[model samples]
Target: MEFGEKIKELRTTNQMTQEKFALRLNVTRQAVSNWENNRNLPDLEMLILISTIFHISLDELILGGSTVNNMTEKLIKDGSETRRAKFNMITTLIGALFLFLGAAFFFIKAHSVEYIDSSGILHENFYLLPTGFFFIFIGIIIFLTTGITFVNSYIKSRR
Candidate 1:
């Protein structure tokens, strides 16, 4: 039997569905489906884990038909992509929050704003514009830097 068929048979014989099996494998159901369909192969580490879980040898898991070496690169790429997406989402949320607060400050002013003078004297002044612009600049910088890093990592991973 083919590798895909073997996986399917093992899964069925164990009475484990794709989702349950994926939970054991720490991967998504789609990934397991792809593996069983022969559309993809797990990495060496995963293959070892699967063999251990099934109480089978690596030879049987791969049918001794050249394991590990032929596994697709997509699994590694998938993990990287998931992490990148999470990082991008967090940064985007924080950046947007900063920008929103900055813009809000431009329209909302404190009734009595106090600040310390250069000479250390206390003074009452509306420093909202400067503070608002400072936040805006920070937000812009965050966007630029994160954007650049995201692009760079994506490019590197493609290779």
Candidate 2:
């Protein structure tokens, strides 16, 4: 039940060729082969990406009763928890900021007056409403992703 074993099992279960799966994962075929053979472990981001692409939980990928799992959990509990917490906090703040900006734009559009000139075109400075909302949506996505990562890591560490 090591990471490599899990990868191989899932890959085979899905009936994906190494090349096809690697392409789907946006990695090299050799990387997939290496993973299946247990020659190397995927890095943090890769592990996350793989877990997401396969619809598998991160815990299922990283915690398979191997020494690496123990080390990874210890690293998270001892060293990386604070960083992850800080990251989640920062993404939340960013999301809030974007949301406020979007709201502000919406308020301006609702409350402001528009004037049309000789060309018969009206102008409103409230165009930023949609722009701000877009940023807010992106920020929220980041925030949620960071939060998910933090919670998953925390739970994995505890286990």
Top candidate by TM-score: 1
Model 2 alpha-carbon drift over 4 Å, by segment: 1-77
Q: For candidate 2, which ten residues in a row score worst on lDDT?
A: 66-75
| Alpha-carbon local distance difference test for all models | 0.80, 0.76
lDDT, residue 51, model 1: 92
User: How well does candidate 2 score on lDDT at residue 118?
Assistant: 88
- lDDT per residue, candidate 1, 1-159, as tens digits? 566777788899999999999999999999999988978777779889989988999776765354442333344566678898998999988888889888888867554567897999887546787988988998998899889998998798689
Give candidates' CA RMSD values in order. 7.6, 13.2
Clash pairs detected, candidate 2: none
lDDT of 2 by residue, 1-159 (tens): 566688888888888999998998899999999978877766678878888878887776777554565426544664566776777788788877877777777777778888898899987775677786787787778778877887887798689
Judge candidate 2 at residue 11 and give its lDDT.
Answer: 83
- lDDT for model 1, on a 0 to 1 scale? 0.80
Return the TM-score for each candidate structure.
0.51, 0.46
Instruction: Give the worst 10-residue stretch by lDDT in candidate 1.
Output: 64-73
C-alpha lDDT of candidate 2 relative to the true structure: 0.76
